[model samples]
Target chain A: MSNKKNALWHLPLIIIGIIALLPVIFMISNSFKTLQESYQSILSVIPNKPTIDNYTTLNHQVNLVRLVWNTFFMATLVTVGKLFTGLLAAYAFRYYQFKHKNLIYLLFVATIFVPFTIVMIPNYLVIAKLNLLNSVIGVALPQLCDATGIMIFLKTMEKIPGSLFDSLKIDNIPNRRIFFNIVLPILKPSIISVGAMFFINSWNEYVWPTLILKDKSSFTLPLALQNYISSEGGTNFPLAMALSSIMIVVPLIIYLIFQRYILNSISNSGLK
Target chain B: MHNNKKILPFLYLMPTGILLTIFMIIPIIYTFYLSFFDWNLIAPTKDFVGMRNYIEVFTDPVNQKVLMNTFFYIILLLVLNFIVPYVISLVVKFFIKRMQGAYKIIFFIPSLFSLVVGAMIFSWLLNPVSGPVAFLFRESGFVLPNWTNSGGLAIIVICLITNWKVFGYNFILLLTGLGSIPKNIVDATTVDRIPKWRMIWNIVLPMNKSIAIYVLILTIVQGLQYVFTPINVITTGGPYYGSSNVLYHTYLNAFVLYKTGNASALAITTFLIFLVLLYLEIKFVEGRSRYE
Candidate 1:
């Protein structure tokens, strides 16, 4: 059942792979290069004489510790919040035949299609009115309820046979018991994959946070890395790359560890 | 506790419902309400401008051009992110059989990082004066063109950076869909001596249409959204508002200009556009599949 082999096709695919990874390669290599070397050998993947100077310069320019902490706190808050809400709602939908059941589920799904840009301004005013501006809570609050979590959880719940829950129901077991005792254990992998997605999305988030978190202490790594966005961050190339390298390390590790599960979840989700 | 049957389901649904209401539904309604008034945030009064803001959205040259640019962004995104990746997945799935995992991993690595980070790395890599490409050009006795300075090139630069991040992701999704197509179908095509291209165009494609449409719709839905980070990082819709799309333009108008009214009007307008676009997509692209 194998198709014809062609070595020529491998060349183009390999080239595309390199193109895909060029920025990452550039970031890693250039972060260690001296300013002189960076400018001199713009094409090099390995630094001739690597130095820690760029990391130190970036350390002085911004509080890298606070930036990482801020991003981690906000992303974790979002992931936990979304996962908690999503799990409860998904369990209810899967087990119950409540009134407006279809309508309520549709409502959750509808939120997925509402682009953030449309609602951002109003949300800003609301956040400002509540005086949450320049705060990590401001960034985390609006993101807490993601429909993607509910969607993913619901899809996972589909794998748990209805008879499992129904048999428990005939035994006069409370739904809560069934959910905590049975569904929870079965759902551990789905939870991890969904949590990974939620964490990564919130970590990578920029626009909403830009509107909310104004102070340097409140700035996430993305915000911190964005000194180059404005000239105010200065024209230090290697330093910026150093910041990027630091920012990506956590997500890269999480991604590698969860790559198989994440890919399966995405492909499975994509099908339906 | 006997009443738990009616109540527990709702209680479970409550948190999600309330959060979505506060964040999504109410905010959307509030945005529409704000669209009618002219206010600069700190101003004491909001002038009831009626249709004037909508009129401005229609007639303002900058807004008009930005609207056009958003259209171009949609088309370019479809080409680069949707069509290109789907084609790659098709070719890879049916043709090249070796090292598929290597290709998938290579593509998926970039998808794990943020578009904002991608934008920054891209900005550094594509630096016109002193970047690697620029360095290459200098060796050839030619100067590299500044992408940020030109409107079209700036848009292209922004999309390409985004393309670097998303192309692999969408490729993986479509490739998975192509791979999931049953082997027996392809075998039947072989029994009839159907050519690869025709079999693909007829059998494999039709079978994969739903996921294909999902990815297609996603390319428009999330694709334009990806432009926000790159537009912010790289161009800031600069060179005279050249690369700005509706998403970032809304941010600029509301936050930067403090023209909250106009921003709301623009937001509501774009929301409607996307809604209609989605309806049409579901009705047309998704609807057509049922008959087959």
Candidate 2:
């Protein structure tokens, strides 16, 4: 009776797993097809005559290497900035008490809900006025002080014992010194977690980059790929699929490299 | 010493506080302010148009349809986001008890991809003429539905794509919640001969209520933003405005029509809806916490 029940429970999961993987398999197979062949039979899992022309054309049309560099540059800068600023803020909030601290923290977390759409117009105006438009910094600046980063950092910092601060005080260390030397080492996991989140968010960003970045030279991977598709005309389904395959592959590589750390961070962040 | 310590915390928090105030709070207030005026980026001067933009937006039939479409799409996405991830997490929990780490990495690959990229991939997969779905249907002797051409189906396709892209993150969250359950409690239930289904239904699901609510709130927030990308890409909210959602309509108003005031009005309305949903979520979570 127990065996029967367990088997029944496993059925739904097996079916769902196959369903979940179907599209990914379809995407990979479709990427290899010729334009005519792809259009001839949209659902063909195996191309009748598989060709590498789609990838070759994608490479020629868009500088894949440059686009990857642009994306990496922005994501890395934003991730590093958030880690630095967020750690500083988190350490201060965790170790010290001040007037209106709660109120200030409240206001900071509240800003998380402020949608990007509300500020896109003004942000554009500010970036243009500063002559920062079409620059990577212009794209990176708005993301530097993310409230979610602060919240995650502070939450992690709160878990450290007060005794650690007292011991540092006994060692005649200043708060800033203690934060940099001791507290930071202990907060590595949180840093990794928040860094991964920030990197992923920055990497996947499109609307801001699309609005602020006008030069094709400055386009990140997503924007470059979008331009490739729209300009090439959307009918070049195989070429579009090829570019997308490249786009998807880069992030998967990064995530796989840091897969354990990223998952550990997500689970630890208590975001669930 | 106490006074100095107290002041230090304020100094540390000042940077974040001031930045949020200027960038976040001010922009929100300015969105409201902009909504009441007929201002354009090209125009030198602004005319104060009190309630006119709101009136036009509320009265327009197209705006009404867009608003409905927005809510409809959000609802559809909410259901998919909840059900798909929950089922996926459960299956993942069953398969890899010891290899949970490896399973997580496999599932989370999709979430790391950019929305534009994911949409592009799905757009290819769903291509009616020579796409995978169309090919499958043709092979099976069934006609393929023109996903992009059909307004309602296009929205559903967008939601499914979004679900596929992001569900792994949520699944990981649920898996973590499941992992945190005390072993002793599970062992006791098992010894009592409580069936796996009964144990999950009565024990595990109830224990993870908070996590479920968190997922729900996050899903709603994400669902709103999903409109921005899909609208920009696939349909541009088209087929005679069949797919035009509230956010897309606002984009059209500001960028295409150059009606800043009307766009701001639509933005404010959307923000209010989000605000209400957020507040309700907070209250619900807080209430549950107290009970727990």
Candidate 3:
């Protein structure tokens, strides 16, 4: 009876899991079809005659390589900038005693509560005023603050025994040296996990990039992909599908590789 | 000595302080300032509207529809995204011991993709002419309506897609919530000969209150904007404002309509509303914590 009960419970999960994967499976499978075949073979999972025409067409329509590079460039800059800011701020808040420290720390975390909409317009105006609009720097500069990471790092840092820091202080180690030699090594897991989260969020960002980037050449993959879909919808289903497939490549790879860290961080931070 | 110590921490804070003030603080102030002026994004100077835009946002029929749609969106999100996912997480935890990894990966893959891509993929699936669903239904002598063309259906579809891309995050959150429960408490219930369903209700649910509250507050705060991607990409908040939530409506006001004053006012109002909601949620959570 218990064995049967387990099977019964498992049945819905199996169904739901397959349902969840349908769009991904469809996207990959349909990308290989000709536009005509993609439209015609609507219900078919496998194409009768797979073709690479859509990808070639996509390459011709837009510089796929350049778009991917732009995306990588922006995501990398954001990751590095956020991690640097978060590291310094978290380290300062963790290790030092200073006037108004609690107040400053609260201010840092307070940004997390404010919706992006509150700042979206002014951010655009600032970027426009600075003449960074339609530039990659404009797209990246406003996003470098890492309130979420600092909060996570601060929490993680608090759990470490004070004796560890006290011993390092007893050795007369400077703050910078202690940060590099001791703190970083201990917080390696958090850095990796939080760093990956930052990278993924930056990479997948769309609305802000859409608001900032106007020139097609400056378009990140999500923006470019959105342009492709809106511009080419209904006519080239296969090409659109190809674009979708390519767009998720880096993020999918990152998630697969760092999933353990990512999941660990999510569980750790979210539950607490 | 005190001054010297203060200098180091301040230096450590400089980067974040500079960036956030420029990006977050200054812009927020600017948004508030802009809310008073009618800036169409063209003229050399903005016209001082002096609460005119706020009055329009409150009195306009289109804004009324937006308010309703936002309410509906939040309700659907709570039901589909929060409650359903929480239940699914519980079910997954209770059953299916072996294939947990597979289930999580599959659910999570969509979230890794940008919302734009996810919207496009689903758009293709729901396409009336060449979509798989259409084709399947057409084969059975039934036709699938253009899902994005209908206002009500579009909102529902957008909410469903939002849940699809999002539920994985909440699932992981709840999974961890369940994981963090004391093993001894669970074992005690089992030894007490409690039925699984009874144990889940009487013990598990109550124990997971904080995480549930966390999820609830997040949904309330984010639910308005969560539908933006799908509404923008799929329907463009169309079918006569049926699918337009306040966030998307705000986006249209500033970007599409160039009504910067209206958008800013709308944004500020939305922020203030959410701030109150957040405060109340914290108060309730804190109140509950006192009992613990």
Scored by lDDT, the top model is 1
Local lDDT at A33 for model 1 = 93
Docking class of 2: acceptable
- Model 1: per-residue Cα lDDT over A1-272, one tens digit each: 14324666567688889988888988888889997888788568999998998899888877878889899999999999999999999888888887777667655755656788788987888899999999989988888887767777888888999898888889998766888889999888888888888898888888888889888778988887776657665666787788889988988888889888887777766755
Two-way DockQ contest, 1 vs 2, winner: 1
lDDT of 2 at B69: 82
TM-score of chain A of 1: 0.95
The lDDT values for all models are: 0.83, 0.74, 0.81
> Native contacts recovered by candidate 2, as a share?
0.42
Candidate 1 chain A, poorest ten consecutive residues by summed lDDT: A1-10
User: Who is ahead in lDDT, 1 or 3?
Assistant: 1
* TM-scores for every candidate against the unseen true structure: 0.95, 0.90, 0.94
- Interface quality of candidate 2 as DockQ: 0.44
| Worst lDDT 10-window in candidate 2 chain A | A12-21
The most accurate candidate by TM-score is: 1
Q: What tens digits encode model 2's per-residue C-alpha lDDT throughout A1-272? A: 75676666556555545555666666677789987887677566898898999888887877888888888899998888777767767767777755566655555655656666677666667778889888888898767777667766766766778897778777878877787787788778777767877887888788789878889888887887787668764578777777767766756666767777778777655452
DockQ of each: 0.59, 0.44, 0.59
Better of 1 and 2 by TM-score: 1
- Best of the two (1, 2) by lDDT: 1
- Mind giving the per-residue lDDT tens digits that candidate 2 earns over B1-292? 6677767766776666665666567777887899999987669888998999899878988888888888888788778887677766765664334445555666676777777876777776677886666877998999888877877888888887788777778788777877888878888887998876788889988987877776777777767687668667778888767788877787778777888888889988878877876676556543432111
Candidates sorted on TM-score, descending = 1, 3, 2
Give stretches of model 2 more than 4 Å off.
A1-56, B1-3, B90-102, B195-198, B284-292
